[model samples]
Target: MEKNQSLVEENEKLSRGLSEAAGQTAQMLERIILTEQANEKMNAKLEELRKHAACKVDLQKLVETLEDQELKENVEVIRNLQQVITQLSDETVACMAAAIDTAVEPEAQVEISPGSSRSSDAFTTQHALRQAQMSKELVELNKALALKEALAKKMTQNDSQLQPIEFQYQDNIKNLELEVINLQKEKEELVLELQTTKKDVNQAKLSERRRKRLQELEGQIADLKKKLNEQSKLLKLKESTEHTVSKLNQEIRVMKNQRVQLMRQMKEDAERFRQWKQQKDKEVIQLKERDRKRQYELLKLERSFQKQSNVLRRKTEEAAAANKRLKDALQKQREVTEKRKETQSRGMEGTTARVKSWLGNEIEVMVSTEEAKRHLNDLLEDRKILAQDVAQLKEKVESGENPPPKLRRRTFSLAELRGQVSESEDSITKQIESLETEMELRSAQIADLQQKLLDAESEDRPKHRWENIATILEAKCALKYLIGELVSSKIQVSKLESSLKQNKASCADMQKMLFEERNHFAEIETELQAELVRVEQQHQEKVLYLLSQLQQSQMAEKQLEESVSEKEQQLLSILKCQDEELEKMQEVCEQNQQLLRENKIMKQKLNLLQVASRQKSHLPKDTLLSPDSSFEYIPPKPKPSRFKEKFLEQSMDIEDIKYCSEYSVNEPEDSDGDGGDGDDEEWKPTKLVKVSKKNIQ
Candidate 1:
């Protein structure tokens, strides 16, 4: 007390309420950290949902394989035609060799003329044999020419049909690659956030460890202070007692002087001595009691302090473990983000390769667009030439003139052979329709599968059950593969339809050509009027039957037309519903992204608190942010211990920023301020979408 008499009043003036509020705030901050973690988890889920909504599946390989199958089928037909040609060629060659050998030896045939008449017969027979061989060779050449022509037609049909679908497939693959890249970027961002979180957690653990150690050291210092206070009190009490005793002696001396005057000198001396003895005894007892009470109080205080220290140690351990776990999680997140980015890049590359392959390599099935147009022009020119030739023949016939022998001898109906192009149009139409339907159904089913997965997770089902469901979904994808055959068949049908339309036009040209040819044939047969008349009747009957079949097909098309119109209306309704759902999904994704950003910021703030633990002096207002906070939102706080700050900041700069997700809705609904549902009307749900862009920190 004597050594520091001026400090007592200053120490007594600070109230208890302010200390309590500081403690409550510390606890509040801890809860905030926990909340931020929850927000991070929520944000991740939201991001996943957003990705699922926007994600597109790739099917390029399947499409290419389908085209290959078509090529194979077309090649099969060509192969059959080639085989027929080969057979005819072999027969012709065999027949030719026999005729040539026989014709070369007419002398031998004459030697057998003793049977001279028989020899003449043999020579005549050899001539017949040679003539038969020539006829066979002619037939073989005609068949080979027909097969070549048919192959050319098939190639043209396939090239036209698969070209559009291949282009569309390639485009879709490119879009998917872009989406994958975006998703990967998002994942990388998340991972970086996680890494920052891990650093914060580690810092938190170190700070907590330091805090516990400091608390222990403070407790020990307080114990020492208590001992020092007790000793000082004892020293002061002893000094005061001595001072009082000295004063009492002086008073006794004064009393002795007075008593000597009042009583006898001997009585005064005895009374003073007895009183002094009794005072000494009383002082000794008081000192002993004081020491005992101080000792008891110190023992009780140490016990209470020790219990608190133990509790603090346990808490410190728990906090350290939690911090480590959080740091680990953050590290994992960072790694995952990096991996996601890498995966995205790889996927993009793969997609590009696939698109290029589909478009570039499948040449046998489809030619380039330019080539198709050119081929079309060529076909038109060919048809024109055929028509002109037919017209001239018809004119000659109409003039009642006999046709030249050359024209009659080399009769080849190229127009009749090319009418098969109509089949290609039918196949191409069916292919496109089926492919579109399959794509739509697959997309919808994927959505449904994702929804079911969400429901299962929300219901807290076990992993095994979800796995079973996943298996079922996989089986369905397999089922789609099995349906590939049907899809391919539809593709063929579409191609056939396209071919049918083109061939129909050709057929019309062929019909005109046929009429001209018929006229020419009629001229050739002018010497045999009955024969010409019979052939004409037969041809007319066949044409009439074909026309009847065509009329019936038209009637069938009309009936199907009404049903298709209704289905198209239904498809429109479904599209609108999908748009609404996508809108909601988009909103959720934005919220998740926002929440993640907020979590990262707050985690940095928690880390700042750790750095603040070792601080011994106040920090500047601007330099206290952690890395997670965006540049503008960091708040400044006074530093407590400079040593802590110095050691923590040695390896890494502490930005000391804090993030709070307290913003409002940022929904992409009616950015024009209204959903365009009304004009000059009070804002309502119908007219305006209340997009609450909440900060989901």
Candidate 2:
């Protein structure tokens, strides 16, 4: 009972274990299904992203747009500022012209009054000539003042015309700035969203079903890994690719550094250009003021000449007798005036030439810088492309898309990548050093130019000031052009930076994808391993159960054989006992047959003796029928057979035979009365017959 109870308990436990295993398997399957669904969804999302990649709001494009817009606004502002500066210059020129006219008028009037007083005593041809010259000078002065007033009025009109345009441009700039800010905010928000998505993806948990599928997936993973590893040629290809990529990366880094240096140089150039522009603007303003002063001084000189002519006319009338002397003096004065004009013209020409030469040099410098910047930009673009290619190669390496066949190959690839990266870094360092040297040289050149400008300013002659003013105006125009170029360069730099940022984002995205793929592969491998373990465990259990069942069957068969053999042995023993009993009954039957034969013989002899006695009894009754009849019967009877003596005489003589026969018949009936052990009692008649025979003997 205890054993039965124990078996029942074991069966219940086994059933529970089986149920638990089945449940676990079911859960595992469910998890696997869920994971598969998730994988499908992820694949769909990837597809969607691919499809929309172009359509998406590219940050680089937006940044470029903003930069372009800003550059445009800056250019407009610079243009407006230039216009204002020109207008101011014009106004100053007009004011100087008016001042010159005023100063000349007063001097001419004072001199004419003195000449008129001297000529009061005489009205000669000399007086008339003096009056005519004075009138012509007055008219010229008045015309100059009128022209100056008209020019000032035109400048004012131009200023009024520019005011509204400038205001409108300012408003437009403000609106563009606001839009740029909004776009920047949007870009930041998008970046935050991207980060959140990445975090969520990272935080996602593995499902139970996926865990269960791990083992089943192992074989597939092995096959895939095997295929990935089988390409020996690919390993060499990968190595070469890595080398190329490394070389490219190094070249790219060198180029990038060069580009950076170029950009820095451009920035320095732009700053210097701005400074030069400011200095030139200041110089232009100073020159304009000086030119005005020079104009006023020239007007004063003209007035003095006009006054001298009036005084000479008065003296000529008074000293008509000394007309020849007066003529000689006038000739000398004319000669002196001619010499002074010639010298002034020469000075103006020389100063103008110098200023033009300076401007040409500055323009040449600007053009050279622009060309260098363009060359650097082109190099930067080339470097950017190379960097992109290198990044692609790195991504391919990291992605393990065509993984190396073995650990050694993988290591080789890794080493190659590292080597390439190191080489590139070294190259970049060298390039940077070279660029730094170049930048220093350029800086020195700029300093020299600045020093030259300072020297020119310090050594400038007073007479050449007007010439300098004209040169300053030309320089201001150059500065405006340079400012525009600077703005353009700045825009280009911003575009490059934006491109770089975009490339970085793309590279980061690719890295993320590679990492995800790697993680997925690892997860799959783990799942496959787990599934394999579970399957192996299940197989082992099944094998154990089958083995146990086989053992149980063998044991049952052995027990059955044992029980069958025991039964057979028992049957044989029963058969032998029955055979022994049957033989004893046969012996009793033979004895009974013998007793029957003896009884038959005794009956025949008794019949014969009875007949003889009956016949003799009629004639010799007195002779034979005496008291000794028993002796006469004994003499007549043949000696009873041994069978009769034993069988009949043991129990009965003639009477004993009858009694024994009757007793034998009665014994058989008595033996038949009880049925228990009846077969054993069935031979009792033979035993009784034997006993009766012994008693008869």
Candidate 3:
């Protein structure tokens, strides 16, 4: 490179001398020509030409002195430039060698670090400065590098050695032109391939669009199916509610019928009690009337006998008193019978049987007192045994020695079910918080993207101008028909620039949207986390409640089992006692009926005795009075009757049936209702009562 610069310097000096010498020689020749012909025509200009020739020769000699300091500084500046050029040339050679080595070595060895890139940038700057200087030198060399001056110098120094580089440069230029041609052909081939790839992409887009349409249809179908399922579930629940209502109504109707039957039984019992009382009054009255009539007849017979024995007055004085007693008894009998009739008119017949029948069921219910005591004793003994066992069980359970809870392993274990919901809620809450943070980040990203888009738009507006101008120049040059191919190249370049600008814009927009979306997702996650936390808290609360309920349920189950056991024992005892009492009641009722029959037979005998007594009373003395006469007229008053008793028995039997039906039907039903879900079950007493009353009424 230094040699090139020196050669350039030497050539500049030679050109200056040659220019001076030529000027001097031209002036000298002009002077000679003037002296030869135009002496008479160039009278004043002739001397001036001679003077110009003399000055030109002096300038020529001065131009030849190239070894001066001014020239040396110029040389030194050139030398510095030469050194820079030499350094640059050597670096280029080194870079080339390195590149060759990089290609030969593996890919791992030739990495460009940031620092290396910076160094290369500095090198590029130095190269750029040298290139500018070189460009100026090329212009100077082309104008001043004269072969004629070298020829003249060769003539002066006949024995000097010299070689020029002109032929070598001409050969280099031809080779460069050939390389450019090959590169252009390759670029054309690449353009053709790019066009083919674009066609393939267009075809793929059509297929993808078809696939997306199919996916949309499937999604719509799934959504419709889900809606149908929801509707079906709703319909099922509605039907169940209707069924429940119908069952409730039926139960209420049955209860109403039982209530009516009980009321009728109570009315019948009251009627029977009244009738028994009336019958008892009537029977007592009839017995008293019969007794009185019999007493009167006895008195009459005694009086008749006394009359017959009047002749023998001293024989029976006591018979006269007896006759008076019988007459008094006859009057009392009539009074008693009338009183009995009046009492019968007010009250009804015999009611003892009715009262007994109704109360028989009540009293016959003998509590199983002995059995209860026995069972209680057994239970107490068992409790004592259980207490001892409990201590041992407690010890085992304390050390986790009890059998595991009666549960199988499930995704939702009772323990995990108790707490997993809360954990998930907490996790979700944390996620929500993270999402919130992400949302903020997305907002920042969106702002950044927006800024990037603005920047891109600003840069693009001016960039297109350069491309457009280049296109116009190219188009003007080509459309002139001088070079149509050049216009296409220019158009391709312009299109590439537009596409790059559009891609940059799209990239900036996409980046902004993606960043915003990411942040939004973060916010959503944070919100979800918060929701999860809330859900977890709710779940924890529910778990705690459920655990308490489970504990309560366990305790209740224990109580229920104990109660059920007790109930079973009591029920068996009570059933046995009730059966015994029922048998005893039936015996007592049969005995009472037999006694009523006896009373009727006794009344018939009393009636026969009354007729005989009336015969004696017919012959009674004028004024007979005694304490025995009062006793004779006493009659049975109206009172209870067997017919009333029978009616009462029938009523009681009906009432027992009613009571059993009402209790039996209601007990199990109420228990089931109690076991129903607490949320949905409702005993609509008002509705039921109204319906029941309506049916009963």
What C-alpha lDDT values do all the predictions have? 0.43, 0.49, 0.43
lDDT of 2 by residue, 1-697 (tens): 8997567555444433333333333333335435535754754554454445342434443444665777767655655654555565556555545644554453333233222222211322233333334333433443443444445445554555665755665565566556555655555554455445533434333333333444444544455445444443444554564565555556545543553454344345435545755665676566445445644644664465456445534433333323233334334434544544554455545544444444444444334344344433433443344345345435544553222111221112224445544554454344345445434543443354344334333453225433433446455655655577689889999999999999999999999999999999999999999999999999999999999999999999999999999999999999999999999777655666655666666556544554554454344545655786543433221222443455543333365466655643543344335433433311311211235544223
RMSD of each: 73.0, 57.2, 87.7
Of 1 and 2, the candidate ranking higher by lDDT: 2
Give the clash count for model 1: 53
Best by lDDT: 2
lDDT of 1 by residue, 121-209 (tens): 23233333333333333233323323433343344435445457545645655554565555455555544544454347776686566
Summarize candidate 3's per-residue lDDT along 1-697 as a digit string, tens digits.
8997566545444433333333333333335334524532442353344334342343333445666868756555644554554465456445534533433232122121111211212323332233333333322332222222233323323322211222333344344445444544544554444444434677557545544654554555455455545545644654564565455455545543443453344335435544754665576566445435644643563464344335223212232333333334434434543554455333212122222222222222112222223333433343343344345445543553222211222212234333443453454344345434433543443344334334333564445423321234334433443344458769999999999999999999999999999999999999999999999999999999999999999999999999999999899999999999998787656654544454345445544544444444444443223555433343432222433343344333444334433543454355446445451222111101111222211
Which stretches of candidate 1 lie above 4 Å from their native place? 1-564, 576-580, 583-587, 590-594, 610-614, 617-697
> How well does candidate 2 match the true structure, expressed as C-alpha RMSD?
57.2
